[model samples]
Structure formats: structure tokens, C-alpha cells
Target: MEKIDNIKNEINYYLNKEENVKEEWIEENHPIDIAEALSELDASEINDFTKLLETEDLADIFEESEKDLQIDILKCKSSEEIIEIFSHMAADDITDILGLLPIQKRKELLRHMKQDDALVVKNLLGYDRESAGGIMTTEYLLLSKNLTTTEALNKIKKIAPDTEIIDTIFVADSNKKLVGSVDLRDILSSDDEKKLEELMDDNIIKVSADVDQEIVAQQVAKYDLTVIPVINKSGILIGIITVDDIIDVIEAENTEDLYKMHGVDEEESSDTTLLQSIKSRMPWMFINLATAFLATFTVAMFEDVIAQVAALAAAMPIVAGMGGNAGTQTLSIVIRGIALGEIDFKDNWTLLFKEAMVGVINGAATGLVTGLILYLMYGNYYLGLIIFLAMILNLLVAGMFGFLIPLFLQSLGIDPALASAIFLTTVTDVFGFFVFLGLARGFIVYLI
Candidate 1:
């Protein structure tokens, strides 16, 4: 932590210095590390630093930084400067950055860009940010299907400097609609007399521009493609979603799931301003607080019982707290399974049976320990029996609900992570208290 703080201080100090640094010194560091160092700097300082670098270099730095920070730097720069940066950046990077900007700003930026660049960015921005279109690069090598292998190679050579790579060259018809893809290796090995149609793999796995990015990532991993083409509704090739962009999509999605499972809002970021963080989290905290009061109110219903058997108050919390922890464990698993597409609605019964089995095993183990402790501490077998029964029952309910609630919410078109934790915990707490007290009333009359 101390080392991190010192690094931050050093970066900030350099940013604050009025004098310019040598370009040689900046070039010595990796772009990603430089971007990280610049991340903590003020927007004005970032803008100044950006102006010093070439457009391509600046775009590389912007792409390396966090999405939100990229927006901050773009906001500080002028439209012309932004357009210059956009023109040089890979299409996918431009799309990701554009998605982070407000709608009005995005339009203004689009208006200022060159027509061809603007059209590509506009096409990308049309799709959901988490879709294939938004994550794909419009930088691909393309050749007419009529071209011979040698002709294709010549075309690739002519465009290689401006294009991203020649790993996979797309063959298109006269209308520029995608026909198939040819691997660079196959093209090199093929006779010059062969046409692109002869060398191309017609059974290409392509994604619609509007296909969800998660689904696109799945397809890429499923097919092990180095590049997946993105086409419009009319089957016109628009862009290519590369493995690198898909990696970012997967990481973002996993991060969102992890945060949501912890009852944290998906939008809350460590780099977010304090006010922004508070704004994102305040709603969830408020909702949790309200649900907590409901749990407290349920406990209050048995105040008379608790008063008579003061030991009930002590033991009741143990049952409720344990159930809550167990439920959270199951909740984390189910939520992640859903996000990763590992668990589906069809697997509901399977998950239910598995959780139930876990509940039985865990409850039996926990109950025996609690029962033994209660018998020893209170010198009453009846009280121990009541506690044991209540614990096992509550844990069973916790496990069942933990797996079911998220599945239920998803079916209803609500986000499972929104308040599933609060709801699940509330159920367990209220039910745990009621069962413990009610069971004690019936089975342990002498204790009461």
C-alpha cells in the first residue's frame, strides 16, 4: 500500500510540474504504464500530455487507460483533437470510448469526424455497447472474390500498412457483402492460378453486429477463431470482433457480476469520484436498510418469548446469522453460474437438488455442533433439541431460496443482483427467528 501511494505521488508530481519533460523519457516507458501513471493526473494535464504525443500514440494510451478515464481525457480535448485521435485508433477502441460518452457528446464527436470514420463509428454505436458491433474492429483486409491468390496477396500488400493484420482476409462480392474468409497461410500455400473463391472457407462463423458481446465471446471461444466478422442485418460486412476486444468484454462482464453478487451496484468503481460512488451505492444501501428493518420487525414479534427465555435471544442470532452466511455462499455461485451461461433455466431442478443436498449436509453438521453446545451450556436436552431442529430447518430454507430467488427474478426480467442478497437474507433472518422461537415454545416449555 505504501509503495502504491509513493508511485501515485511521483506520477502526480510529474504531472503537476509546469516544465515539459523530454519525449525520450516518456518513450522509454511502456504505453500502458505511462497511461496508468497519467490516470491519476488532472484532465488538463492529460490533455497537455496528449497533445505532445502523435495521434496513434495518444490513441494507444487512451485505449490502455480505464474506460471512464478515457472519457475524461476526451472531454478535456477539443472535437478536432478527438476526431484526430478517433481516426487513428482501432475501430473497436473508438466504439468502446464512444459508448462511455454521453449521447449528446457522442453525436457531436461523430459530427466532427471524417465521413468514412464517422460512418464506421456510427454503425458501431448503433449496437448495444455489450454487442458484437460495439466490440468489433472495422479494420480488416478485404479483397474481391474474383481476385486470384496472387492478386489477393497484392491487394493485402497494398493495404497492409493501413490495415490491422492479414491473418484472415475477407472475400466480398461486388456489393461488398461478405462471401467467405481466407487464411493468410492457405493463401500463401495456394497456387497463384487459384481464385479467392477456391481458397476461401465458405463455412464461416460470423456474428450479427447486434448480437450480444457475451454471445460473441462464446462463439469466438467455441470456434477458436482469431477474428470473427460482424455484419449488419443485410449481411454486409461492417467490422471484425477480434480476440483482444472480446477479452475486455469478458473481463468487464465478470467484474460486473462479482460486484453485483456482493450487493454492490455494478456501476460503482474504485476510480469513480466519491460522489459518484455514493450515488451508485446509496440506493442499494437504502434498500438493504429497509429490508433489515423488516427482519428486525419480525424478531420483535417474538419479544415476549425472547424476554421469558433470555437464552433464546442469544441463540436466535446464531441461527439467523449462520443461515445468512450459507445463503450468501449459494447466492454467489448461482449468480456467477447465470452470468457465465453455465447454469440455465433448464438446469433449475438440477441446481435445486444440489443445493438441497448441500443444505442437508451442512445443516446436519452445524446442528449437531450447536445442539451439543446448547446442551452443555444450558444443561437441558429439550432446549438443545429445539435449537437443533430450528437450525436445520432454517438452513434448508436458506439453501432453497438462495438458488431459487435469482432464477425467479431473471424469469421476471429483473436483474438478480439488484436486491437478491437483501431479499434472501431477510427471508432467512425472519424465518430463522420464527422457527427458533416457535419451536422453543412448543418443545421447551420448562425453559420458557
Candidate 2:
């Protein structure tokens, strides 16, 4: 921490200089570090310090900044300055920043950019924010299938500067339809006279523009690819999604899954206002309250039995709480499996049987320990036996529902993470209390 503070201090000292010392400092340090240090500056300092950076340097730093800092930096610049920065940024990056602004501000800024660049950004923005085209860059090396290895290499040299990635070169037919891809290494090793059509690998992996970003990320992982090309309906090459973009998609998807699982809004953050936090959480809280009433009603049905056996009332929460814990453990694993495409709605007997057996085994173990402790506490064999049976049954219920509910919800096209916990908790709590209290009522003579 102290080291970071020192770096920030050094950067701040350089920023205050009147000469062009800031340029040399920027050139010497990483853009990410510079952006981090600059994030601490106030609005006036940011406005003045940013004006000293060249378009390319400013664009590099902007690309690495957090979304809030990126907005702040942009707000500090004029329309002409923003246009210059846009010229140096990748189309995907420019689209991301523009997407954050109000529609009127976005349009006004687009009007100031070059016509071709503006068109590219507009086309990108037209796709769903969570789709492949939304994350793909228009800059990629596209070689003609007819070009010889030597000609393709020469073209690559000229185009590589402006392209996002040159490791893999896409090939297209005469009509501009994507046909194949060739690694840069393959092109380098091939005979100069060999045509790209002969040298290129025809088994190309690609996605259509509208494919979901999570699916795109899965494909990339499955193929171990560094780049995947995007095609239009007619198979015309449109853009390429590089590995960096796929990584971002994976991270965002994981974060969304986690938030949904916890009943928290995905957009809720540390920066959220107090009112916004309450607004985001109120619906889930109300749903949980409704579910709580179901458990309370179940307990009320057994109130007479609990009152008769004071020990039963004391031990009531133990059974239900343990079942809730067990259910939660199963729920987390199942939801993760669904998210990673490892589990689906298919009737896999092996998965279901495995989970059931696990539930039964764990339930028996927990039931034994609980039964022993209760027997020692109350000095009554029947009281211990009642809790023993209840624990085993509740845990078995926990395991089965934990595995089944998410799949059922997914089959109905609902995100299982969002509502699975509520249903699972209600089932465990209600069933756990009913079984424990019912057994105590039946064995009243022995327990007393």
C-alpha cells in the first residue's frame, strides 16, 4: 500500500510541472498505473492534467480505467478532444463508453467523429449489449483466399498496424464470405507460391453476430482459441472477438450469476446510494418475508405438541437450521453447474441418484450426532429417537430439492439462481419442523 501511495505521489508531483515532464512520465510508466493515480485527482485537476496527454496516450489510459473514471475523464474533455481520442481507440472500446452516456449525448458525439468510424460504432451499438457483435472489434486482418503466401504476408504487414490481433488471419472468398483461417506461423512456414486457399485451415470456428456472449465465451474456451471471427447472416465477415474481450465476458457473467444467486441486483455496487440499495433489495426481502410466514404457519400447527414437551420447543430450530444449511450447500453446487453448462434439464439418473445418496449419508451422520447430544441432554431415549428420524428425513429432502429445483426453473426459461434459494429454504424449513414435531406428538407417552 505504501509503495502504491509513493507511486501516486510521484505521478502527482510530475503532473504539477509546467513543462512537458508529464509526457516523459507517462511514457516511462504503464497506462493502467497512470489511470489509477489520476483517478484520485479532483475534477479541476483531472480536467487540466488530461489536457496535457496526447490522443493516443489518453486513449490507452481511458481503455484501462473503471467505467466511472472513464466517464469522468470524458466529461472533462471537449467534443473535439473526445473525437481525437475516439480516433485512436478500438471500435469496441469506443462503443462501450458511448453506451454509458445518455442517448442525446451519445448521438451528438457520434456526429463529430469521422463518418466511417461513426457508422462502425453505430452498427456495433445496434447489437444487444450482451451479444457477440457488441464485444467484437471491426479491426481484423482479412486476406483473400486467392492470395499467395507472399502476397498475404505483405498485405498483413500493411494492415496489422490498425488491426486488433494479427496472430490469426481470416480468409474470405471472392464475394467476401468467410471461408477459412490461417495462423501467422503457418503463413510464415508455407511456400511463398502456395495460395492461401491451399494453406488455410478450412475447419474454421466462428459465431454469428447475434449469438449470446456467454455462448461465445464457451466456444472460445472449448476450442482454446485466441481469436474467433464474427459473421453476418450471409456468412460475410464482420468482425473478430479477441481473447481479451472473451475474458471480460466471462468475468461479467460470473459476477451476474453470483449476484442473482444471493438475491442481490447485479447493478448494485459499493458506489450505490443508500436509497438505491434499499430499492434494489426490497422486493427480495418481501419475498423472503412471505416465505417466512409459511414456515411460521407450519410451526403453529405443532404448537400444542411443542408446548407439552418443553424440550421439543427448545430443539425445534436445530433441525430446521441444519436442513437449511445442507440445502444451501447443494443449491450452490447445482447453480454453478448450470452456469458452466455442465448440467442441464436432461434426465440424468446418475446425477440425481448420486445427490440422493449423498444427502442420505450426510443426513444419517448428522442425525446420529444430534441424537446422541439430545439423549445426553434430556435423559430420554424417545426424545432422541424423534429428532434422529426428523434430521435424516429433512436432510434427504434438502439434497433432492437442491438438485432438482434449479433444473426445473431452467427448463421453464427462468434463471435458477434468482429464485432457487427462496423455494429451497421454504421446503427445508417447513418439512423439517413438521417431521420433528409430528414424531414428538406420536411418541408422547415414551417421550414423557
Candidate 3:
């Protein structure tokens, strides 16, 4: 609370003209800080404050803001000022914001941009939003293989303004095909006469433009690359995906999986309207209510068993609840392994056996304790034995469904993280209730 108030206070001080928000202030503070402040300001104040900010600074703050907030900030700026800000921003980010606008508005916004800049964004907008071409930037420095070390250094200085990072320079042939790459140190260490072809290293890792963003992130992570070049189907370098873009992709994916795991829409934000949140959540809640009926119907099938021995009613829920928790634990591990690409079909047999043994061993241990407790409380040895068998059966069933559900979902081309939990819960709850109640009904005389 204190930190937030302090930031707000600082921003307000500048807004009221009590203190000047200098370039030094913008440079010292983070862009996210400015965005948060802007998010808190009223429409009039937002328009007033944006006029004082430099185009690049305004662009940086917008880049760090949420999509809705970015649109709001843009509404505060004039068309000319907005185009100036776009000129200072990355094409990928500009296209992302523009893509969210109405088609007519999007076309008008692009029409205002420089012809070359607009063309680059138009080409980029053609790619899928989750593809390598979607996230890459055309702003990269490329060197001709024929240039000498000294000549390449001069070319880099000339083109550095348009480049994002020059630490690793990509070298191309006369046909504009990527041949090799070299570190900036490779140029500085070599003699002035050494050509780029002689200094560049081979065996580069590159992704095609059409490849999925997730696969692009994985390759970057696997190879520990700072920037990966994106090539066309014809093997010509078009754009580059930087480490920052991969980081964003990883964060977005994790957020999506997290939301889907718990039955929330990934696109819903903290500022989502209350009615919108309800609309988004209502369908899933209804689905969950229907699943609850499945458990209730299973219990209904053995109502006679529960009526005869009231003690069975007390113990039945314990059995089902335990199975549900156990299934969740196993599926958590399996789901993570699937997302990280750690699980393989070759090791799947081993994995299934391991989980099954875990179920047996854990079931025996837990069943023994729970059965002993029931026996002590109810003073019925037959009741204890019945529960012990039921528990073991349910737990083994839990492990089987938990292990298989995610794989089945994946095979069907569905996200395991989204649907596996719902299926796993239904399996555990239905089977857990059925096994415990059916066994009690069979040994009703002893249970009495």
C-alpha cells in the first residue's frame, strides 16, 4: 500500500505542476511504473500528461501496459502523435495493438504510417499470432559475407539505428540467404582484411517463419540463444525472434495453462467487468454442477446400504475425498511432464507401472490406518475389512485414470492441461463412491 501510494503521489506531483517530471525521472524509473500511474489517471489527466512525455517514453509505457490500457492511452493522443509513437515502437507490437482495433480503424491507422513501415506491419499481420513470423521483428542487422572485418564494422555503424541488437551479427550470401553468424567480438579481434565468411561460425540454429511460437521458444531455450533468425520457406532470412519475445510467449502460455487448469478464461483480466466475469465463468460452473450430480447419482444407487448402516455414510465421503486428492497429485506431475516435453511413449510403460505401484503401496498404507480408525470408532471388524478393500480399489482406479487421462486428451488434439483435470475428477469421484458403497452393501450383515 505504501509503495503504490508513493508512486501515485510522485505522479500526481508532476501532473499538478508542483514538480517537473524530467527526462532524468523517466530514465531512472521503470516503464511499468509509468504505465501503472497512467492507468490510475482520469481521461483528462491522461491527455494532459501524455503531451509532456517524449514519443519514445510514451511508447515504452504503452508497451508495458495491458491491451485495454494501451488502447485508452492511444485514445488520449492525436493521430499524428500516435503515428510518431508507432514510428518509435516495434512493428510487432504496433500490429498487435492495431489488430485489436476495428478493421476500418486499423486500416486508417496503418495508412497514416510511413509506406515502408506500413508494408512491413501488413506483411507481419498475415502470419498467425502464435507463429514465429508473428513475434519476430524485421529490424536486424545483416552483413554481406564478402565484406572485410573493417568494412563490416562501418556498415554496422551506419545501420545500427534500425537494428535491435548487434551483439551477434548474421551474415548472408549474395542471394540474401543466411549462411552463418559471428559474435561482435569476432569482428573486433580479426585483422582489418579478414572477410566475414572467414570469421563467421556455421551450424546456426534457425526457425522457419511458419513454425509455432511455442516450438520457437523451446528451441531458443534448448540452445540458450539470445536471438534466433526466422527464415522463409525458400531459406531467405526475413526477421529475427529475440529473447524478450520468447520470454513473453513463455509467460502467456503459462498464464493460459494456469487459467485453463482451474476453469477460467485466459483472456479475462483483473479489470474485467463483473458481468463479463460472470458470463465467462457461468458455463464452467454449470458443467461442474452437472459433474457433481454424477457423484450424487453414484451414492444414490446404494442408499439402502447407507440407511442400514449409518456408519457407512460417515466413511463413504472420506473414501471418495481421498481418491480425489490422490488423483490430483498424480495428474499434477503428469501434466507438468507433458507441458515440459519430458514424457515419452518409450518411457510411458515405465511411467504407468511406477504410478500403479505408487497407488498400491500408498493405498495399502493409507487403507490400513483408515480401516484401523474406523474399526476403533465403530467397533466392527467386518466394517474395517470392507473399507480397507474399498479404499485399495478406489486408489488403484485413481492412479490409472490420472496417468491415462492427460495422454488421452493430448492424443485427441486437446490441451491436456485444460480437460484432463475435469475427466480425472469425474473418474475418481464416481469410482470412489461406487467401490466403497457396493462393498458395504455386500457385507451388510457383518457391517450391522
Candidate 4:
């Protein structure tokens, strides 16, 4: 704690210094640590520090920082300076930074950039920000089929510094359409006189520039590719999405899912302004409040039954709360499975059946204990029987709704994680309360 506080203090001191700090100090500190320190500073202070660093250094820092903080810094920089920094940054990094920027600012930055760079950024921005084009780097080594191994090597040497990676080179047709690929190892090992076409692998798995980023990550993992080529609709090679970029995509996607599960917008980052955080969270909280009231209303409907048999009221929350918990467990697993592409819509019924079976097993175990406890406490077999039946039924319902609600929401093109929790919990609560109260009422005379 003390060490963290010292780091925070030092960061604040440096941020407010209003003088250029030593480059050596900046270089010696870990980029991640510096980013964390910067995160603690105000946006304007971050902007000042960003301007003080070289474009390359700034790009590195920007990439290391959180996405929202990156946007904050971008918002503070001038359009021309932002363009210059983006121009010198890696294509993947530029794409990521641009993704967080406002559309108007992004367009303005593109307008100020070099035509080729601007075209690449514009093409990337054209796709869904969560797609292959948006995450891919436009920097890659390209060779022609006509080139000899020696010629290709020379071309690689000329462009190696400018390209992201020369280890994997793509071979394109005369019209710049991707034809095949060859690794640098094969090129170096082969005869200098051999044509690039002779050494190419035609089975290169390529993703369309507009392909979903999650799909791109899946393909990369499936093929165990180090670098996957990105092509336009016409099959003209535009760029390559590297494994590193895919890793970032995966992490971002996982984080988004986590946020969504908690009823917060996935776009809300830790670095988001307090106002932005409130905006993102308030709607969900309000929705949750409404759903909570619905649960309260369900309980209220049985107020007379509860007033007569106060024990029912005392035990009601336990059944409903347990069902809610079980339902959430099922919901979480299903949602994560869907995000990871492990679950398919075609297999929805199978998943539902599986969850139902799990529910039966869990419900039986939970019901037995509750039934025994009620019988021992009240000495009323009818009350125990009612509680047991209600527990089993509620658990089964919990499982069913938990599995189906997310699937139903997803089918409607809604985010399953965002609204599924409220819906599932409400179902469990209402049904649990209704079953417990209705059974008690039906057996009311026997109990008296």
C-alpha cells in the first residue's frame, strides 16, 4: 500500500511539474507502470505528458494504457499531432486508438493523414470496430509470384524496417489480389533461382476484412497461424492481422462480456469519466430497480397468505434467493459459452436439456435438506411436503429460464448478458413465491 501510494505521489508530482522530465526516467520505468501512473493523473496532465514524449514513445504508452484513457489523451491532442502520432504508430495500435475516438474526430484525423495511411485507416474504420479489418495492421510484406527467391529477399530487405513482420510474406497477383503465402524460413532455405510461386503454400487461410474479430481470433487459433492475411471483398489483400492483435481482441471481448454480465455497458471502462460511468450504469440500475419491484409485487400479492402463516413469509425469501443464485450460475455458463462460440443456436435444445438435468440433481439435494429442516422445526408433514415440492419446482424452473432467456434475447439481437439476469431472477422470484404461497393456501385447513 505504501509503495503504491509513493508511485501515485510521484506520478502526480511529475504530472504537475510543467517541465520536461528526463527521457531516461521515462524509458527506465515500465510502460505498464507508467500507464497506471498516468491513469491516476487528470486528462489534461496526461495530455501534457503525452505531448512531451516522442511520437513512437507516446504510441507505446498509448497502447499500454487503458482504452478510455487513450481516448482522453487523444481528445486533448491537436488533430495534426494525433494524425502524426497515428501515422508513425503500428497499424493495429492506430486502429485500436481510432476505435475509441469519436467518429467526427476519427474522420478529421483521417482527412489530415497521408493518402495511403488515411485510406487504410478509413477502410478499417468502415468495418465494425469489432471486426477483422478494424483490428488488422496494414503493414505486411508482399511479394510477386514472378519474383525469384533472391529477388523476394531483396524486396523484403528494402521493406523489412517499414513492415510489421517479414518472417511471413504474402504473394499476390499482378492486380494485387492475394494468391498464396510463403514463410521467410522457406525462402532462405530454398535455391535463389527458385520462383516465389514454387515455394508458396496455397492453403493460406485468409479472413475477409469485414469478418468479425472474434471469428478472426477463432480462425487464428484453429489454424495456429502466426499472422493471418486480411483481404477485401474482392479478395485483394489489404493487411494482416497478427496473433498479438487477436490476443488483444480476445481480452477486450472477454472484458466486455464481464461488464455486460454485471448490467453495465461493455463500453464503460475503468478510465471512463465519472459522468460517463454514471450514464452507462444508471439505465441498467433503473431497470434492475423496476425488476426488483416486480419481485416485491409478487410477494405483495400473497400478503394475506403471509399474514395468516407468517412462517411462509419467513421461508419465502430463502427459496426464491436460492433459485436466483442457481439460475445465475446457469446463465453465466451459457452466456460465456455463447461468447466463446462453444454454444450454437442449433444445439440450444440440447443445452436446455442438459441444464434441466443438472437442475433436477441439484434441486433434489437442496430440497431434501430443506424438507427435513421444516419438518423438524414445525412438526408439520404438510408444510414440509409443500416446501420440498416448491423447492424442486423452483429449481427446475430456474434452470429452464436461465438457459432459455439468454438464448431468446440473443435470437432477438439483444445482448444476452445485459438483460438476462434481471429477467431470470424475476422469473425465479415470482414462481418461487407463487408456488410456496399457493401450496400453503391449498393446505391451509389441514395446517389449522
Candidate 5:
């Protein structure tokens, strides 16, 4: 953190100096660091800092900035400047920035871009922002399968400056259909007369353009690939998704799932305004309150029993709280497994059984300790027995509901992570209270 602060200070210092020094300093630092520093600056400072760098340098920093900051930085530039910056940016990055802008502004900017570049960006913009096609770049090496090693190498050199990745170059047939891929090393080592088709790996791992980003991420991780090709429905090569973009996709998806699991909107962040935060959070807060009331109603049903056995009130929270904790533990694991594609509907029965057994074992262990503690505290044998049995029952409820709720949500075409914990807590709380209190009601004479 201190190092970033130092870098930010240094950038600010250079921005105020002569243009030559500022250009040199910007060139010396990483684009990510410059972007981080720009984020720390005020509006006027960011405007001034942007003016100091050339379009190419600015484009690098622009590509590294967050979507909001990217828009802010663009707001400081003229139409001509923005177009020039767009020219230097990768197509995928340009599409991302444009996607965040209003439709009119996005169309105007695309109008000014070079006709071919605008067409590419427009095509990219047509896909869902969370799909493989949306995160892929058109700027990748594509050599004809008929090209000899020497010809391919020469072609690569000519286009490498505009390409996003050259480590693996894709091959296409005369009909422009993707056929195979060849490593840069393979091309370098092959005989100059050898054909690309002979040297290329015919077996390829690729995804359709419309495939979800999560599935793309899983495939990339499973195959240990640094880059994956994207294809259209006709099996024609369209774009390539590099590892860097995949990393960002993975992070964004994980953050989204985590936020949804906790009943928070993924769009809300610490930097959001008070009103924005309230808007995002109020609905979830109200939903939780409703669930809380349901638990209260369950307790209200057993009010007479609770009144007679005062010890029930004291021991009630322990049952519900422990059950909630246990449910959350199971929910977290199941959600993670689902996200990673480890759990499918075919395995639901086996998975549920395994989790139920876990609940039983954990319940037994925790119930023994809880029973011993209650027995020591009150010197009532039945109180200990009631709590022990209640713990086991409540935890069993926790495990079963936790495992089933997510799968049920998923089968209904809903995101399993969305409010899953909220549902699990409601189930655990209501069931835990009912079981613990009902047991107390049965043994009230002894407990008293």
C-alpha cells in the first residue's frame, strides 16, 4: 500500500513538470501503476495528468482503469483524442469502455472510429457482456493452414504489432474455418518449407461465442490454458480470449457470487454514495426482516410452553445460533462446488447424503459438549438431555435445507448464490426453534 502511495505521489509530481519529463516517467512506470495513481487524483488532477501523456500512453492507462474511471478519463478528452485513443486500444478493451457509455455517446464514438475498427467493436458490443465473445479480442494471429513456416513467420511479424497475443497462432483453411493451432516455438523450429497444417495441433479446446463466462473460466482452468479461441456457430474463428481477460472475468464472477450470497447487490461498493448504498441494501435488509418475523411467529406459537419452562428461553438461542452456523458452513461448501462445476443434478442424492452424514457427526460432537455444559450449569439431567437431542435435530435440519435450497434455486433457473444464505438461515432458525421448544414442551415437567 505504501509503495502504491509513493508511486501515486511520484506520478503527481511528474504530471506537473514539463511534458517531456512526464512522457518519459509515464513510459518508465507500468500502465497499471499509472492507472492506480490516476484513481487517487481529483477530477482536475486527472484531467491535467491525462493531458500530459500522448494518446498511445494514455490508451495503455485507459485500458488498465476501472470502468467508471475509464469513463471519467474519457470525459476529459476531445472527440478526436478519444478516437485516437480508441485506435490504440485492443478491440475488447474498446468494447468494454463503450458498453458502459450511453447509447448515443457510444454510437457517436463508433462513428468516428475507423470503419473496420468500428465494425469490429460493434460486433463485440452485440454479445452479452458476461459471455466469452464479449471478453475476447479480434486482434489475434490467424495464419492460413497452407502457409509455409517461413511465410507464416513473416506474416506474424507484419501483424504482431496489432495482435494481442502471438505465443499461439491459430490456423484456418482456405474457407476461413478454424482448423488448428501452432505454437510460436513450433513454427520457429520447423523446416522453412513445412506447411502450417502439418505442424499445427489439430486437437483444440474452444468455446462458442455465446457461452457463459463462468463456463469459459472453468474450461480454461481445467485445461491449464493461457488462451482459448472463440468460434461462431458455423465453426469460423472470431476471436481469442487471453489469460489476462479470463483472470478479470474470474474475479468479477467470484465477487458477484459472494455479494449475492450475502444478500448484497454486486453493484454496490465501499466507494458508492450514501443514497446509492441505501438503494442497493434496503431491499435485502427488508427481506431479512421479513424472515426474522417468521422466526418470531414460530416462537410465538410456543409462548405458553416457554413461559412455563424459563430454562427454555435461556437455552433456545444456543440451538438456533448453532444451527445457523452449521447451515452456513454447508451452504458455503455447496455453493462453491456448484460454482466450480463439481456438483451436478446427477450427483444430488449422493451429495445430499454425504452432507447429511456430516451434519449428524458434527451434531453428535457439538451436542455432547453442549449437553455437558448445560448439565453442569443447571444441575438438571433432563435439561442436558433436551438440549443434546435438540442440537442433533436442529443441525440435521440445517444440513438438509442448506444442501437442497441451492440446487432447488438452480433448477428453477435462478442463480443459486442469490439470497441462498438468507433462505438457509430462515429454515434453520424456524426449524431449530420449533424442534428445541417442542422438545422442551414435551419434557416441561422435568425441566421445571
Candidate 6:
């Protein structure tokens, strides 16, 4: 942390001076450090820092930056400067930054970029931001499958500096279709006259442009690939998605699921203004409010029973609260498993059965403790029995809802995390109250 502060201080000293900084203004600093310092600086400071930094360095920092800051930095650059910095960046980074720009500004900036680069960026922008094309880079080497081992090595040596990842080189057929791939080590070790086709591994694993980013991450993980090639519908190689980009997709998806689980907007940033924060959160709160009242109405149905036997009222909260906790415990596990692709609609039955058994076992244990306490307090065996049965029943309900809510929402093409907790809480609370009170009412004569 202290070293990071020093890096920021060094960069700030140069930015504070209004003149052109001959001294490196974070151009030589690590991209992570530059990103951290830029995050802390104002628009003017960012503008100053961008002006003095090299385009290559700025590209590095831009690639490492958050979405809002990327736009801010892009706006800080002139058309020519934007082209220079953007051309230096990976195509995917260009798409991300351009996605955040105003329509007019984005168009103008793209117009100013080199024609081929602009075309790549424009085509990439058409893809969904969470798709394979949106995160893959066009800056990659596509070697001819006919080239000899030495020829391939020579080509790699020349193009290595321009491409993102060179650990594996893609081999293309006459139609520019991705035919096979070869590791750099194979090229380096093979006889000079060996044909590239003889060495290339033909069973190439690749994905179409429209595949979800999560699926892309899964492929990368499954194959343990540092880079995966992106092919178009016609089997033509378009670009490649690196594991670094895959890591970002994984992190962002996890964060989105986490935010949704808590009823928060996935796009909400920590730096969002108070008004913006309020706007995003108020709807969720209102929904929760409605659910709370629904639970209130359920409780209100037993008002007469509660008034007659006040002990049941105090004990009722315990049953309902415990059910809520149990439901939430199952909810967290199911939601997490779904996000990781471990649980799905196909596994719903097995998952439901497992959770139900888990619920029964957990319920029996927790119910026994509650029953004993109730028996000691009221000295009424019937009341204790009523509470114990209610506790077990409510827990089973909690477990069922926990597995079903997310699975049902997913089948309906909705994000389960967004509404699973809300519906689960309502069911557990209302049902927990209903069963506990209903049983007490049935045995009301014995309790008094």
C-alpha cells in the first residue's frame, strides 16, 4: 500500500505542474498503478496525465481501468489522440471504451481511427457486451497451415510484438478458416523442414461469436487454455479471447450474481451519486415492503388466537425467524451452484430431494431444542408438541422454496438471484407463522 502511494505521489507531482512533463508521467509506471492514480485524480488531472503519457502506456492504463474512467479518459483525448491511443489498444478494449461513449462521439472517434481498425471495432460493437465477440481481440497471429516449422517460427518472431498472446499460434486454411493450432514450443523444437500441418494439433476447441461470456470462461477452464480462438458461423477465424479477459468475465459475472442476490442492480457502482444510488435501490425496497405486508396479513389472520394465548405470540416469531434463516442458507448454496454452472433445471429433482432430506434432518435437530424450551416455559406437553411439529413442517417448506424459487425463475428466463430471496422470505415467513399458529389453535384447549 505504501509503495502504491509513492507511485501515485510521483505521478501527481508531474500532473500538478501545468507544463509538458519531460519526466515520465506514469508512462513507465505499472498499468495497475497508473489505473489506481487515475481513479483518484479529477478530470483535469486525468486530462493532464493523458496528455503527457505515451499512447502505448495510455492504452495499457485504459485496458486496466474501470468503465466510467475509460469514457472519461477517451473524452480527454482529441480525435487524433483517441485514434493513436485506441489503435494501440486491443480490439476488445476499443469496443469496451467505445461502448461507454456517447453515440456521436463514438462515431466520430471510430471515423478518425484507421479504416481496418475502425471496421474491426464497429463489427465488435454489434455483439452483446457479455458475448464472446465483445471480449475477444482481433490482434492475433493467423499463420498459414502450409508453412514449414522454420517459416512459422520466423513469422512468429516478426508478429510476436504486435499480438496479445503468442503461447499458441492458430493455423488457417486457404479460406481463412481456423483449421488447427500449434504451441510455440513445437515450432521451436521441430525440424526446420517439417510441415506445419504435420505439427499442428487439428482438434482445435473454439466457440462462435455469439456464445455467452460465461460459456467462454467455462471452455477456457475446461481446456486449461491461455487463449481460445473465436470463429464465425462459417468456421472462419475472427479473433481470440485470452484467459486474462476470461478472468475478467468470470469476476464480473460473479459480481453481477452477487448484486442480484441482494436485490441490488448489477450495474450500480460504488462511485454512483447519492440520487442514482437511491433510484436503483428504491424499487427493491418497495417490493420488500409489499412482501413484508403480505407476511403481516398472514400473522393478522391469527390475531384472535394470539390475543387468547400470548405465549404463542412470542414463540411464533422464533419459528418464523428460524425458517427464514434455514431458507436463506439453502438459497445461498443453490444460487452459488447455479452461478458456477453446477446446478441447473436438469438437476432440479435431485437437488430438491437432497435439500428436503437436509431440511428434515436439520429441522429435527433445531425443533427438538425449541420444543424442550417451550415445554419448560409453559409446562404444557401439547403446546410443546404443537410447536415442534410446526418447526419441522416450516423447515421442510423453507428447503423446498430454496431449491424451487431459483430453479423456477431460471426456467422462466429470469435471473434467479434477483427474486429468489424475496419469494423465499415471503413463503418461509407466512407459512412458518401459519403452521405454528394453526397447530396451536387446534390444540388450544390443552394449552390453556
TM-score of every candidate: 0.86, 0.95, 0.94, 0.86, 0.97, 0.93
Candidate 4 pairs with clashing backbones: none
lDDT scores in order = 0.81, 0.89, 0.86, 0.82, 0.88, 0.86
lDDT of 4 by residue, 117-223 (tens): 77776777677777887777888998899999999989998999988988899999898889999999999999999999999998889988778898888888878
Q: Which residue pairs of candidate 3 clash?
A: none
Global CA lDDT of candidate 1, please? 0.81
Error of 5 at 100 (Å): 1.0
Which candidate do you rate higher for TM-score, 4 or 6? 6
lDDT of 2 by residue, 25-66 (tens): 677777888778777778777777777677788899999988
Q: Over all chains combined, what TM-score does candidate 1 have?
A: 0.86
- How much is the lDDT of residue 123 in candidate 2? 99
Query: Which residue pairs in candidate 5 have backbone atoms (N, alpha carbon, C) closer than 3 angstroms, thus clashing?
Result: none
Which segments of candidate 3 are over 4 A away from where they belong? Answer: 1-3, 18-20, 344-347
For candidate 2, which ten residues in a row score worst on lDDT?
Answer: 14-23
In order, how many clashes per candidate? Answer: 0, 0, 0, 0, 0, 0
lDDT of 1 by residue, 223-266 (tens): 89878998888888888877887788788888876777566767
After superposition, candidate 2 runs with Cα above 4 Å error? 18-24
Which sequence of candidate numbers ranks them by TM-score, best first? 5, 2, 3, 6, 1, 4
Select the stronger candidate by lDDT from 1 and 2. Answer: 2
lDDT of 3: 0.86
Error of 4 at 259 (Å): 2.6
TM-score of decoy 3: 0.94
Model 5 per-residue lDDT tens digits across residues 1-448 = 7767887888667666745335666667888877887787888788887777778888888998887778788888888889999888888999999989889989899889989999999999999999999999998999999999999999999999999989999999998999999999999998999999999998999999999999999999999999999999888999999999989988999999999988778998878899998888899999999999999999999999988877778898998999999988889888888888987666778878877888888888898898899899989989889888888888888898888888889888889999789899998889889998888889888977
